[model samples]
Target: METISIRAPSTPSSATKARRSARTRLPAAIALLPTALVVLVVYIGCMLWTVRLSFTSSTLLPKLDWFGLTQYMRLFANDRFVTSAENIVIFGVLFISGCLIIGFLMAVFIDQNVRGEGLFRTVFLYPYSMSFVVTGVAWQWFLNPGLGLQKLVRDMGFESFTFDWLVNQRMAIYTIVIAGLWHGSGLTMAIMLAGLRGVDKDLWKAAKVDGIPTWRVYTSVVLPLLRPMVVTATVLLATGVVKLYDLVVAMTLGGPGIATEVPAKFVMDHLFERNNIGLGTAAATIMLITVVIVLAPWVYARYVRPQGRHA
Candidate 1:
């Protein structure tokens, strides 16, 4: 056979170099300028200012008077601060897990070729669409004993029914949690549904041929494949947990004597209401440290490290 040799087309190195030089001068720099400006103007700016204030005896006006670690010491000793830390841990664990489990179940049920698919999706996602201000009030009313659950149950002739968690000091925090779950699970469901839709349809067909129980296919096979989405959902939930304030404020008012008090609420109360900037910054610093400690490893594995084989 007559030999035929085809030369691979190649661009000149000068052209390649010019393109690379252009990337550095224009598109890449344009892409990065906003991010760099944002980091400086917002993220790093707040972080430095916060840390600086933490070391100061600043009050309402954020004065520049230095006062070592007195605020940190006071923060460590404050019973409310201690309790807030404990509550955050409890809330973080319960809220993240509850949202994921319930959200996953809801997503699965909704994905089952159900009736009123759009209506059901809208109903589930409406919480995400609506502001927490309204949702918190609605949940508060629903949880209130005299106005809502207890009264309704009593009216239905179960006179002894007492769902009074909303008022009880010890039980009220969980009420915030319940409302938090209700408000957040919708977002979680949406994320998981997107994940499910992206899953290979062939997996289901293979599972059927092998007679694998659907639940087993999910728990054993599918769930493992969904690590990325779960991580994304958890991070979203975790950040919300760290910034948990409005829900506590609107629903409970951090009331029943600060029983449902959260760190973010504590920060806001000090920073704006109580005029205690140093203490507020201390709390914020602690929260920031906590988030870093808990999240740094996962973030490194997910984003920083070499991508591991999914299977």
Candidate 2:
């Protein structure tokens, strides 16, 4: 005898699952709608508004009239702005490198499972918890020639112990770099320490079995594995470098004759103190562009490239 075979329908189950999933997700979608609207209206809207103002002839107020690239031309021609750009470049290089080097060393030290590990971690990370304003103020006092290190050294019978970089026109920016390193390295150390802890014990044992030097193992094998942490620290430090205002304000006020002036300070001075809104917005726009340029590559590699591969 021949038997007829039949398959149960699948469409109704698939339709039911789709409807159930939609019902489950509807509340979450509704919850996120307001936040999405605020981001669009507040953050993106303000960015567009700022960019628009950069192309105007506004001074002491915002004007909607078109003014071409006149503000940019004036900005580039200004000697103070030129110096500010140079100072920021110098500060950015020294500050980022110094923090990374010092932070890595500190992380290595803490990774040895030293006694009082918690206490050391707390001490190392404590500076990062303080605001930049406080760090700047404290360092300024400590670095002040007459009131801080110079005075103490001089009082101790070394009258020629000149450590007055804080007030010297040529060396003033390095003082800001020093303060930045102190405030930022702690955070980097914490990041690197976490990365170090995640390293496999088997790798260390393998290196030991191979008679490899500890330093060689770290530089050759371990450093590459910590690239993500290094990138994270770099991004955080770079953002700090870009928005560097309150620190300079508290520490130098952009003086020893504008020697320590940064792009952020330049924008503030033009927008508020100097009342050149057009030029200020142009400076701000340049900064925004710079940040976008720096981040685009990382974003593409991190998010976009992975998705492309999956696709």
Highest-scoring model, lDDT: 2
Give a tens-digit lDDT track for model 2, residues 135-169.
Answer: 98998999999899999999999999999999999
- lDDT at 117, model 2: 91
Model 1 per-residue lDDT tens digits across residues 92-179: 8999999999999988888787999889888887888767677789889998988998999999999898999989988888888888
Query: Each candidate's TM vs. the true structure?
Result: 0.89, 0.90
For each candidate, the alpha-carbon lDDT, in order, equals 0.85, 0.89
Question: Clash number for every model?
Answer: 0, 0
**What is the TM-score of candidate 2?**
0.90
Regions more than 4 Å wrong, model 1: 1-27, 307-311
Candidate 2 residues lying further than 4 Å off, grouped into runs, are 1-20
> Candidate 1: how large is its RMSD?
7.2
- Looking at candidate 1, the ten consecutive residues that score lowest on lDDT are 1-10
> Residue 202 CA error for candidate 2 (Å)?
1.6
